[model samples]
Target: MRSWGKSVDTMSSSSRSSQKENVSASRFGPKLCGYCNEFLSNLDLNFDQLNICGWVHSMDYHDIHKSARSGCQLCIVLRHDNTDPEDEHWHKAALGAYYKGRASIMMFLKSTSTTCYSAMYGQLSETISYPGTSRRQRVLDELDSIGAYHDLNYTPPKSTESQTAWELCDAWIKNCIKNHSRCKILHSASWYPTRLLYIGHFPTGYLDRDLSSFNVQLHLTQDKPPKGGYMTLSHSWGFIAFEMLKLTSETYEYRIKNGFSYIELPKTFQDAVRLSRFLRSDYIWIDSLCIIQGSEDDWIHESKAMVDVYRHSKCNIAATAAQGPTEGCFYPRDPTIVSPLEISLRLGGEEENPIPKKYLIVSDHSWHRSIEEAPLNKRAWVFQERILAPRQIHCAKDQLFWECNQTTACETFPFIFESHIEYSKGAAPLALNITSLDLTLSEMRKLRFCETRHDPFPGNFISYPQESSYSTYSNISRFDRTLAHLEGATIDEKIERLRRNIFLDWNNIISRYSSLELTYKTDRLVAIFGVASRVQEALKDMDIYVAGLWRSQLPWMLLWQIRISDTPPSYDCGPSWSWASFNRDVYFYAIPQPHDRVLINVDEAHDGHTVAKQGAASSHRISYLKLRCLLYKIEPDIAANSGKQSRTRFTTPTNPRLGFRPKSLHTDCTETDDYWHQAYIILVIGQHEENRLWGLLVRLCEEEPDCYRRTGMCWIDTEAEPNITEHVRGATDKDKA
Candidate 1:
């Protein structure tokens, strides 16, 4: 075999020379063609005609409007003068077939190494369709049959103006408390925290302030929990006003125990207290007030109960408009934009006998849109608050939005809002729950395929339009949607599937959570621990619970990829081997179903000092893992690099993972340090797919000899297959798996 580190220039030159000599002259159609009295000549070709023709130099073809550059493969072979890559213009009469379409655009972008091209393609592909009809037209036509088209076109009246959000919040809360029992403060469910603040009462027109002293109480264990439900405030801590009363261990024991008052509190907390009293809720849970600041024990204890605190509350008051607590909950918006448009339709033809119709077009904003554009909605901590809370009243800039487990409503079109039940259940069809009869495999495949195509990305956690769309207007209710998703022959089988899917969803949630920014890096595991706890409860029957991965399907969970173009932190947050190690975006692709993948035996896990242990979970902390598996030394590919030394790739010494090729291990930035070269790869698991063994790649830590981190995720089929023969290397004396 040739050496691995060959120069790329020598290889390309030799290959090109051989290709030119073998070209057949007869294929050029007499070598010349006349177009507009200009002679165009055909040249020797290599690769394929489609590949050559599809080569585009610039992606922004419209901005660079000109003939195809000579750098394009097709330009060297076939002479074309006028064809616009962006337009229907063709080069030579014979090669005039190229046209602008999504497929061609994808082809041109696919050859690029830049991830930005892929991101751009993803955006452009969303609008691509067959010529003649715009994507927007398709959407409008789809809505036409449902009578939603009128609502779609309805505009606000010229004279109408927006209303104050405070009035709207009052109206929504009073109506829900009176009519919706589900939203009413529960009398029996009484849960009290260690300390509570009595936000001074508010009167009809405005809130009365008693700045001299603040009412604070330290609830006694003997005291009965509040008879009525409490309200929770979910807002960003924009700035802490020290001038306000501060709580500490000393104050909790001495000053606050008797009766303390303070003049200062953030605007958000003040607004929340006002809303709480207006809604008739007695108690409120404000973290800054309830928990002693800088007390680790209290923080940890309270943080663990985050899910319960939000879930049991009567309602969470989300300051969606506020960037910080100081800004308050209310946001200013244009009066004209917030008001609905009026439309008049003519029923009869001709002005003499025309029948005029008037319709009110309510500019109803989807709940998804309201949450997506909100500033507070972007905070990571608030996400869990929104998800776990049984109900939330979003104080958005334009209007107040009501959301609970049952439904979502906004001020402009409260009754017309979508049901949250179906949305929360995900994309399963409603039919599976209605009928006890088994669905044929063919039927199940049809339903599952629909879920696969939605392409739920990390961003979906933030935008949620796909899930909302599936649950609201789709045929299934949220309750039934769960049944549809977990369809199986028996209840036990269905439960198994549900457990597996729940874990999958956890992976999805973590993928998004990892990408989000946090004020404290240490809070990484703590921020998502509640979600992990919830998933653990769902998979309780399963024996294995490793750090972030489950023992039952650890192999599949290990197949996570840190998204390309995302910059990982220089300092590790957790173990490098775990996705939590990098404070960047990570994603997991579902493993192909029913594959023959065997977990490496623990006995086989160790070589020298390396130790392998089954994964274990700790309370409110990161999981630790160690596995001793196959190790491979990386080397430069000389044969592949003959033509360009700069473009040379690193490959394994011996053929590893036969059918599965290694993905590019490099980060998006070209200036990244050569850490991978010094890094060693460990095979975590082996999969038998299509008669070949595919192994997952893990990067070994030089500092911590036994530990390793996940590198580029999958070793898949690649366009340029480098020589990656495995190199046999002996393990260190103490290198235990």
Candidate 2:
């Protein structure tokens, strides 16, 4: 067989599946049966309408689900578009569509079968680049290739543990190390973490080594920074009835000297050790083993430096596919599923390009499956681990993926979505474009294309944006674009934007980080403290971290509002003045009016955060926060207030006594409008040009002398009566925390 593969220029996104490769796929490509050929003939018609595909007669919902487990290529592709929770719906939809006999229905087909996809060329040709427009266009172009095609690969590897998988992984690392200078780390001995687990040298590869001889030991690195490079592990501890393996205060001394056997470690850790050794790294950091378990002081101290452990390491291994440690980092996958299916088309062409032919399909939701929708990415701590790590190898359910600060490449796509430019050896240095305007690190990260902003105030109640990204097509995300434009979503791209706003970026991070789940409520601030430290470092210490709010971004940061979630807040969190006080997500949704100035003065700001149980996490209750600001008694339109939370209009502009009619006011508590009826408006900002005011709705703190607790965020329309702004300033300033 003769083969020539060229790296294709592109972009795009999907769900996943696997299947046995069709014999002779390496030559003329898999021969599509007559049913698929006829089905392809009616490409425009939906699957349900394509009754010509007699294969549907054998199609069963249980078969699809069964095939999903058995590594059926087509079924896995369907799963690429779904999370586990949503899989049954797609399966049911396929069956229901079969019965309906509609055009909208062989369920959605792709390139792995008949239509040929070009992404695999990258892996084949050893090409790596940033995202651009070409890939998506190619994917969009190949949309019609949904047929019963055979695997492009000639043979299947034994499992993800095969030499083939490791070869692919090695290629990614080789390119990252040799080609990507940015991803390379220059570590001094000082960079080592306080503790590290030393997986004793394996002279033989893990697969070849005798299990009885393999040893593991705790290497306390505080006294001596190891000379060799190290790797880090990101895995789920998972819930269990009994205690899992760990280094405790009691075991600390014994673990350091005696070191347990390889069998003592969990399956995930063992897999990590194998990978680390395969990568030629002897030392690896695992949280539970490195940090003293059941010891709060040690955990807190080590957790504080968690950022460096990941950031300074040579690489981080993410067991992204696994739910718990028991699942391990590897799985036996059908090779055909990872390898795109192939079929040569007979459609007539002018020799340069083909005609009206549709063939080739893709799992557009691979990102959702391999990482975003994966179990590990959901953890709050993983966010920072992902962002801070210089590079990472994701052990996905079906395949492996590489992610670094520079780019992301999966086994399926095997390349990045970069603009395609023909290259030859010794070509002139490639010119990289740098934006002339000096953007802050945060500002630089926020410059994304096709991002949508939700209404700041929807109806009367504010609706918070969830973790979901805005999608243009149900299967395609806004991030799904061409490589030339870098429109495709990178794993960390969205979070990267949050790094830009300096102060505003922190708000974005809080909104994002706060939405994640935490096993320990007290770790709310602890889990994200590393990210905070990074943001602070970027700020060059321009802003002081007063609990969650920045001292400089005050008033704005203090305006963090609770999301309308059924999940209740933990009173154990920081002072009510900070967003960290809430267990559910809180958003800095209220934007200060244009040219708006803070009318409130921070008379006294002190961070008296004591640890929740007994330690010093950032979210501890505040020592003191006194804001001296004028308060004006305001009233809402009874009718508008009664109806579906409508905007309170300033109908009585003639009477200043009616006060500043709040354009929008949503209190944290829904139990009563009584607080709204007796609200005092404190000016957080006054926008003169816009004729609007943004501030907090507050009520007097009965016990405190001239103090108040924030009730809700208030936006007032001064257009009706501009003089109303003066009345707010005329009111007496009261201390508030």
Candidate 3:
């Protein structure tokens, strides 16, 4: 076969036709073409529908787009998976030969075909699809049938820039409280933020001045929880300064004597207070307003309590679309844009058959467009808040969205919005229960042993009292009872199952947390510390959170690969051995089979000598990791790096035929991107099933003679691989090249 781009770079239109041939291949039955259809059905090529699939890795992004635009079905599917369905040109791109219909079309086919059920993995997980053949016309006709049911159906109201929208938002919160009786609240009353801004006044700013505005302040003199529910505001403090309005040493006493004037606050703050008071909440917690902005001691204590502050609240009011304070929470929008496309189709899967079935094909990117990709959701701090909070009301550009621990829905498709987070290869589907995020590492290892699963098929999306998935995840003690009530026959099995589940949840958390951007590099671990502390408490020391990883999942945890294009942190976040050491997206790919051989031992973690800086999480900094592991010297391929090194290449000292080459290699960026001559591999784990050796690439730490700095990771597979742990243990210093 010719190289992939050979045809694209040179071949003319007429010559490119290799006869529109059809053949039965790869179990998806008859195929349309040799490339796309064939590859889609190949099990070996399947990598759990992750971001970097075999399809994405095999073809260049530009090349794939070219093929997709030129009418390649396979390329179309690949491009579709990578992009937001909201792209108008995407519809055009999917049109003609490349078009596979919108996500709703896929939803109809998958829901009807052999391919769905994760609709709603507690409403978000894999969106499986049938690998079989079907024409576009047939898919469209089927969707129309569902559209015909519109008259009898109760779709979510189309959003509007009206006061009614605010009422609907309130209804969503009320529904959660009334319906989800078992949902969790992570913060203990003792850990509540020391202060909360009163939201008694209207958003527009109010003062019944004659009645004494000074009485507005409720200065707490005792350790008593407030009587009324308090909501938390999640927003971006824009660059525009509002120093006079914020709480500080100078303003604290003044604010205590006199509550805030809503009119003087930023637009975002004004809207947040408005929503809070409207919801009957007595107080609202905003970081800058509630926490003393300039006081180091106060900021440290308050910052550490972030997780509890947000999780403790009745709800989080997110100004998702607001890039800055001036861009208030309420965004004006056209109601028609978010409304579903109602249509009627034939009863059966025939083209133009005359029996009617009504349907409402909603925007495919409903929740995603409104919330996930929202500007505020991208903040590093929001990562923890999003997961920890029991429920949230997101104020977005297109519409209002509701996200609880179990479901994510928007005004556009107010049912379970069918969307998927690009799950990493080894991470577990996000936990259905907020308190269930595990602090263990075994999930990463055990995932390879368990059967790969797809959730059971679900029935039609109907209008009603929505599906209830509430769980009573009150605390770690509650989890113990939950464990006792589990399906496993043996207590040990139940515990193990819980362990693995939480571990999987941890994987998802870390992978996602790493992808976010932080204003302060030091806040990397600080921002997520509450999650760590809670999970640690829940696990009751099932696994220790050392730096950015768990103690139990070491070797395997260390195997996590930095996402391609993930840049290095400008300052030290943690040890080179930990993913927290860098500021970038990272993921673990479960390619090699299971393993039990651990070739390294981590010593007692050393603490950083420096004082925990302001805005840093207390008691969670590790200076460096001291590991006692077998090391092997490897020589660089000089020919590969004759110029400035883009990526350092390595090979074993042995002959080419017998040498080891890593399956994947990622080099860290530095002040000077140069090759390290004194390169070595720290043997971490040995896997027998895949005959692979997983290790870390390190170089002698120039600053410290005996220490080593992790430069990258290595996964080597050789046909004649030996017992890695045994081989490394028997070798000596002479093995160095």
Candidate 1 regions exceeding 4 Å error are 1-189, 199-224, 239-245, 258-263, 331-335, 344-369, 419-480, 485-489, 541-546, 564-572, 590-592, 596-623, 628-631, 644-651, 654-696, 718-737
Indicate which candidate wins on lDDT. Answer: 2
lDDT of 2: 0.54
Q: After superposition, how far is residue 4 of candidate 1 from its true place, in Å?
A: 60
lDDT of 3 by residue, 1-737 (tens): 22211112233323323311222232332223434443332312221221221111122234445555555543444444343433332322211111122222222111111222111110111121101112234223322332332221333344433545665566666656654433433324434578877656444323222322322342442455667678888887666655435778888888877867656677787777767766777777877777888888887777767767876788999899888888888775544445443333332223434443333433344455456677887788887887767688888876787776434556654433323321112222233333345212222233324444422111111111111111222222223344455644444444455554554456656877788878878777777787776666655535677766666666667777775444654335777776777778887643223334566766655535122543444655446666666676787767656778655555556443333546557666542345457778877766555566788888887777887778878776634344443465465535532
Weakest 10 consecutive residues, lDDT, candidate 3?
Answer: 117-126
On a 0 to 100 scale, what is the lDDT of residue 508 in model 3?
57
Query: 320-348 in candidate 1: lDDT tens per residue?
Result: 87877777775554333343222222212
lDDT of residue 135 for candidate 2: 36
Q: Which stretches of candidate 3 lie over 4 Å from their true place?
A: 1-161, 181-191, 201-225, 241-244, 347-353, 415-486, 563-571, 590-594, 607-622, 637-659, 670-674, 718-737
Residue 76 of model 2 has an lDDT of 49
TM-score of each: 0.59, 0.70, 0.67
Q: How accurate is candidate 1 locally (lDDT)?
A: 0.44
Cα lDDT listed for each candidate: 0.44, 0.54, 0.53
Worst 10 residues of 2 by lDDT: 429-438
